[model samples]
Target: MDSASVYTRCQDRLLDLAAELTAEQLATPVPALPDWTVLQTYAHLAGVCADVVGGLVPPSDDTTTARQVAERAGDDLDAVCAEWRSQAPALLEVFARETRARYRLPALDVWHHENDIRGALGLGAQTLDADQLAHFTVGGLARGWAPDVPGVRVVAVDTGQEWLLGERADLELRAEAFELARAVTGRRSVRQIAAMDWKGDPSAVAHRLPTLPAPEVDLAV
Candidate 1:
């Protein structure tokens, strides 16, 4: 898939969403990332793009991401969104020129964060491309990182897609395409995963995910 295009589409929608928020909405805390307000989340998104365009790796570490958010602490929602837009062109160029799988990660991050922002604002799910999500989950995340689960058969009930994520299929995790992606990407807590449709034990792979661990608290979204 054209990851750069996906990134652009998701970014545009997110920015549009930001444009409609009230000051109170911007300051509202994201349940997915409780420590960050809606505006702070945008700051990180923009910061990641800036770092990439500037030839620096985007900050995945807490210290660096915190610094990114801190640097934009004074920026209002409009300014923060503008900063994110400013980096879009250059970042798109960077992503378009790449053949490596890591380039798709930014698109995935934006997609995930867009949903997080929406959920925080009490909005329903955005009509995003589930196919892109499926692509990212099957390639960039599950296959790319290769989690240490004994075996995982991920069945996306909403999309009718399935992926075997380990050496063998010993466990089946069935959920909506978005939920599956969210679960593996740290948006969902262990309790949330348990609440999903699972064959065998969810615990077998709940914590062994390759990306961020599941948060302890079940996010309201």
Candidate 2:
């Protein structure tokens, strides 16, 4: 499906999942993110969905994004979900007319947090949207998350998709497409990212990976 479809479906899914959860589950610690609970992640995501339609992306960074979540991360679970639901429609409407470039951030954010909530609740995962994730990882490495050193050649074992970042590439990383995407998006910790097969200095490359917040637990690889 397209990015907008992905965003809308994900939002609906999270809302449904949140509704099924108790207040305690909503507050469950997500080791995948630093000092954040499921409610906080949802609040952060809902905040961004609301912010995008209001014509404010607030510069894609940890500090700013955290502030957005903090602003709306009220104590009441139902109230927090309501806050998110209220703004989801406008974000979906905007995504319908715009390209992936417009919705990519929120789309990926939602997916990343989907796994985060699941992981936190000890809910087993089956698979992810590999097609979208593959492309998102490429864009992340190329633009928003580019490493400063020589490019590392990333090879997705399942899809056989490959991409290079930086100059004279000496590093090689191989893993499931979804795993790499998770690591790049900060859903997985440095340890989990390093768990993937590599030929070069994985530590060096790991340091450069994007930081949504380093997960406390080992994420699926």
Candidate 3:
């Protein structure tokens, strides 16, 4: 689906969005990601692009990554935004050259963070390609995203896409394409996801999801 091109388009919009924000506004805390301000979030988005383009994610742990992003985050919002703008083309170029399956996480990372900025600023829903999202949702599930809920049959009613994950084939989740992608991307609240149509044990799968109001203890262990 040319995820790099999709990511570039989405990223250009985000950079434009950042250009509109004031320094004071950039410092304001984001509701969607309380631990980071808009500036830090912007830095993080840049950091991810830099890591991907440079292949320099040392330690390969969330804590280390967070520390690097936090350390690099600055009050110069325009410069940070500009940095991302400059670096993105190369990242997108790499993405374009790589295999489709290689984009599983980068596509999700950029897409989720774009929505993160959009959601925090109350910009409302951004344009999301259903087919792309559906592809990622299916891929994420197959990659053991929700391990406890083996046997999930997902159908996006909008695009009429289907994916059978796991061997059990007992539970089914029916939702719009974007919701399904957001659910798997660690964006949706637990309550919001549990409310979706389910043919089997909801709690079993719901608890397994990487969700919001995040767990207090880091379960990286």
Candidate 4:
């Protein structure tokens, strides 16, 4: 499947899973994501989706200030999620018609947030497939935090999956793409991955990982 297909499938799956949850279940605290409940997870995913869609429709000539963007997104969680779900069809339609290069948001943002929701619910074992994994690896490198960080190589210790980033001379790390993505995104700490025997310069590499914004709570319901 193409990148657009991959994105749509991932988004649909998340929506399906979210539809399965009860309000109470949505509010249940995710042990893995201590700061966020399932409801917050849904809101975050939906909010980010909306943000990406907004960015795509008319490509921004200049990046909007963070506060201004946040203001445009509003402080209401349910409103954001509702707006996102309502707007997704148009966004997906546009995405299907455009090339990856034309996409407004980085593909990694979609994949990572999908994983975030799944991970919080302990659904990783069920949701992510091999193809999605490959897409995520590429997306992570493409949307990596620092443009200046030398490209690093990743070797998944268990599965032996290998992918290259930046320059060959950069440090090589051995860990599953999922774990590496999580660590890079700050969902998981360096020490946490180290316990799993991931090898890398944690201090130097960790700082280059993309930072997710703070999650918003669902107060409307």
Candidate 5:
């Protein structure tokens, strides 16, 4: 699918899930993302959409702070979802009018956040399609964030996907895209990575990945 189509479909899926949640459920802690509840996750997702869209078009020299974005979204989960829904069309329109090279934010964030919400809500039974998975894997590796660790082949066993960063394929680790993404982003443990086989030191590679803050459970009480 094209960028606009993907954004629209992602928005639809998010809204559909949002509509099914109760206030209590929305505030409840997410098992997958222990740091954020459903409500907080919704808020963050909406805030990200607003921030990115606003960054692209911008709002007349009005620079919004992170706190402001969170505050504006408030604790009303549905309202936040509605705002995201409203923004999606405009964002899609803007994206359609522009070229892919000009697209703001990394492509991984788009799919990562989508998977994040789905995993948190237990709605992602089906994995990403072959094309999407390949895109994410290759794009992630090419992004060059992985450290110069020797013998580490970042492999997604489910998809038979592998990206050899260094000279040797000494470490063979297996995980789903989300898990792999999280590991690459330093949010999850390499130990949590299933079917992991390694010859060299995994810690060196782990250090190269971005250190994601531990998932927090703060929500509207």
Candidate 6:
């Protein structure tokens, strides 16, 4: 599926899942985001869509994010889902037209958050469009985190897909694309990253792994 379709379908799936959840389930704490509950997470997602639709840039600052959550504090899953669905179509058009990675961020963000919500709800990983999107997400994260010099050569064993970031291919990493997507996005701990197949010392290139430090404990999804 295309990027727009991928994001649209993911949003639809999330809304469908929300429809099945009770208030208690919606209040479930997301392990990835300890400070936010499932409903809070949905609120943030909807807030982002609102920002994007309104032609405002999404900020990662704590104050802005906290405000986003606070604005929808009283909202339930149904309300938040409706808000997101309303703003999604406009963003979907942007996704379909923009070729730059910047425009692709929403698709990646929504997919990543969908899995986060799924995990907190005790749902298994959704594999529908995972394989198609995993490569892009993993490669983007790798490139974004990698240094200007030669750093890592990531090889997706499942699909034989390869992404050589930086100027040269020095450190080789072998793993499934989906796992690499999770790992590079701070879903895996540093210790877990070290456990993956590596041709060179993972610690040598640890600085290029993630923008923030990986989780201390394994976050099984």
TM of each candidate vs. truth:
0.89, 0.82, 0.82, 0.59, 0.69, 0.88
Q: What's the C-alpha lDDT at position 187 in model 2?
A: 68
Model 1 agreement with the true structure over 132-200: per-residue lDDT tens digits: 676576545556535554677888887888888777888888888777777777878887877788889
Give the clashing residue pairs of candidate 4, or none. 151-165, 151-166, 151-167
lDDT of 2 by residue, 44-150 (tens): 88778777888875335778678877787554677778878888888878778666464567777777778778888988662557657766766567565344565
Which clashing pairs does model 6 show? none
lDDT of each residue in 16-69, candidate 3, tens digit only: 787689767777776656688878887887777777788743222567558647
**CA lDDT of each prediction against the hidden true structure:** 0.78, 0.73, 0.68, 0.54, 0.54, 0.77
State residue 169's C-alpha deviation in candidate 4, in Å.
4.7
Q: For candidate 4, give the lDDT of residue 65.
A: 26
Best by TM-score: 1
Best by lDDT: 1
Cα error of candidate 4 at position 170, Å: 6.7
What value of lDDT does candidate 5 attain over all alpha carbons? Answer: 0.54
Error of 2 at 139 (Å): 3.4
| Candidate 3 vs candidate 6, TM-score winner | 6
Q: Name the candidate, 2 or 4, with the larger lDDT value.
A: 2
A best-first ranking of the candidates according to their lDDT comes to 1, 6, 2, 3, 5, 4
lDDT of 4: 0.54
What TM-score, to 2 decimals, does candidate 6 have?
0.88
Candidate 5 error regions (>4 Å): 30-35, 56-65, 73-75, 97-107, 118-126, 129-134, 142-148, 176-178, 194-201, 210-221
- Among all windows of 10 consecutive residues in model 6, the one with the lowest summed lDDT is 204-213
- Each candidate: RMSD: 2.2, 3.0, 4.5, 6.6, 5.4, 2.4
Candidate 6 lDDT, 1-105, residue by residue in tens:
377877888888988888888989888999877889989989988987787677655335578678889999988777888889888888877666666666666
Which residues of candidate 2, in runs, are more than 4 Å off? 58-67, 73-75, 98-103, 143-148, 167-169, 211-217
Q: How accurate is candidate 6 locally (lDDT)?
A: 0.77
